[model samples]
Target: MSRIGVVTFPGSLDDRDALRAIRLSGAEPVALWHDDADLHGVDAVVLPGGFSYGDYLRCGAIARFSPAMLSIVDAANAGLPVLGICNGFQILCEAHLLPGALTRNEHLHFRNRDQWLRVEQTDTAWTSAYQPGEEILIPVKNGEGCYVADPATLEMLETTGRVVFRYLRGNPNGSQHDIAGVRNAAGNVVGLMPHPEHAVEALTGPSTDGLGIFTAVLAHLGTAVPAASRDRR
Candidate 1:
């Protein structure tokens, strides 16, 4: 089975939830601490959302130097699948693995709600279960969820189809081009500003829109895709 590593930083909020999601998706969830120097040979890594270092020094800035991140960077560069959600996205940008930055919401308030998103592109390891143009709703919560970048980077993302998920109905955080997620050039690393871990089960309502992401990883591990969303395109 694919052992997915969920990295836990000092103030991580969703490590458990991420682990549970991995298990529900039929993969073994491995606990990885920020201070650890090893990845335990996990198949994939998930940087769960949270206010690491209490969001001090600007979101993921302080957490960037955490020991675990060093190995993560090396592993990611070697083509290990890595998914960074919300604050995790911030860390990925600070780590220079992904382009662009996540800034404070235009509203200047922490937004928490179920959001509609379109699978703009799905060629990456984390989003392969989704098809082009598939629309889904997952919960988004963060004060710094606004995605931004220089014109050149934005242009590159637009032209190369690296923008993976996009806000559908409303641009809650006023992100550039309504981008909810993006992938690295090789498509092995993905970072997004929403919490897919919160929408995996039916009890969470708003549909099981986020399960495809977890299942996508599971499918890569030799598991079959769930029938409920088989044709999610």
Candidate 2:
């Protein structure tokens, strides 16, 4: 089976949820520690959401320097798939894995809601299962969910088709251009402010839309190599 790792930082609250989602997606969920430099030979990595390091210094500023993140930086540069959700998204930005910064919401309140997102780019490794322009409902909860970037960076993201997910209906956090998620230039790394792991099961989530994210990665791995040889990588 394909092994996908979920990194648990000191304050990570959704690592288990991500693991469950991965298992439900037909992949083995490998538990990874924030302080461990080794990836445990997992095919991909997920940085689950929470106020890492007590949200001290900055939301993800401290966690970005964790030993695990350092190794992830190298693996991601070598084309390993990585996903970051909510607070995980902040860590990706702080680690320079993705562009832009997530700032406080315009309303300055902790907003939690079932958010509707449009899949603007599906060519990415973590989004291939989704169709272009497909809409999915995922839960979003955060204080610093507003995404910001300079004009050039914003233009670059928009022009290159790197903006992966966009908020529909009303803007939840006043994010620039309604951008809820973005991917790196190589399309192997993605960071979003929504908690997709929370929306994987219909019994609890708004819809089963979030399962697509996990399944997409599995499919990517399947095509990348045969199942028996997958873990060897």
Candidate 3:
């Protein structure tokens, strides 16, 4: 079975949830530590949400320099599938694994709600289980969840189809272009402000829609798409 690693930083609150979601998706859940450089030979990695490092120097700023992240940066660059949720999204940006920055919400309040998201891109490793334009409900809770980028970078993301999930009913945190999630140029790395792991089970979450995000990776691993076959941008 494929092993998916969930990295737990000092303040990570959702690592267990992500591990459970991965196990439910029929993949082995591997617990990874923020201070460990080894990935444990996992096929994929997930950075769960929380105020890493007590949100001391910004949500994910401190955690971005952790030992594990140093190794993750190299693996991610080599096309390893990596998913980041909520504060994890902030870390991805801080690590330069994904473009743009996550800033405070326009309302300057912690927004928590079951958000509707449209799957804008399905070719990505983390989104292939979703159909283009398909809508899903997932929970979003954050203070610094607003995604921002320069005009040229935003245009590049839109034009190259890197925007993955977009807010549907309403813009939760004033993310640009209603972008809730995005993938790296090679489509192996994805970062989003919503907690898909929280939505994998209908009993606890808004819907089971989030299961697709985890299942999609399992499927992608099964296919073993070559790095040369992936889109360059």
Local distance difference test values of all predictions, in order: 0.89, 0.92, 0.91
Candidate 3 Cα outliers beyond 4 Å, as residue runs: 223-233
Off by over 4 Å in 1: 223-233
Q: How does residue 26 of candidate 1 score in lDDT?
A: 72
Specify the highest-lDDT model's number: 2
Q: Write the per-residue lDDT of candidate 2 for residues 9-98, one digit (tens) a residue.
A: 999999999999888788899999999999999999999999899999888999999999999999999999999999889999999999
Per-candidate RMSD, Å: 1.8, 4.2, 5.2
Candidate 1 yields a Cα-based lDDT of 0.89
**TM-score list, all predictions:** 0.95, 0.95, 0.95
Q: What lDDT is reached at residue 92 by model 3? A: 98
**Location of the lowest summed lDDT over 10 successive residues in candidate 1:** 224-233
RMSD versus native structure for model 3: 5.2
lDDT per residue for candidate 3 within 1-233, as digits (tens), equals 78999999999999999999888787889999999999999999999999899999788999999999999999999999999999889999999999999999989999999999999999998999888999889999999999999999999999999999999888988999999999999999999999999997758998888888888898899944334223211
Pull out the clashing pairs in model 3: none
Of 1 and 3, the candidate ranking higher by TM-score: 1
Q: lDDT of candidate 3 vs native?
A: 0.91
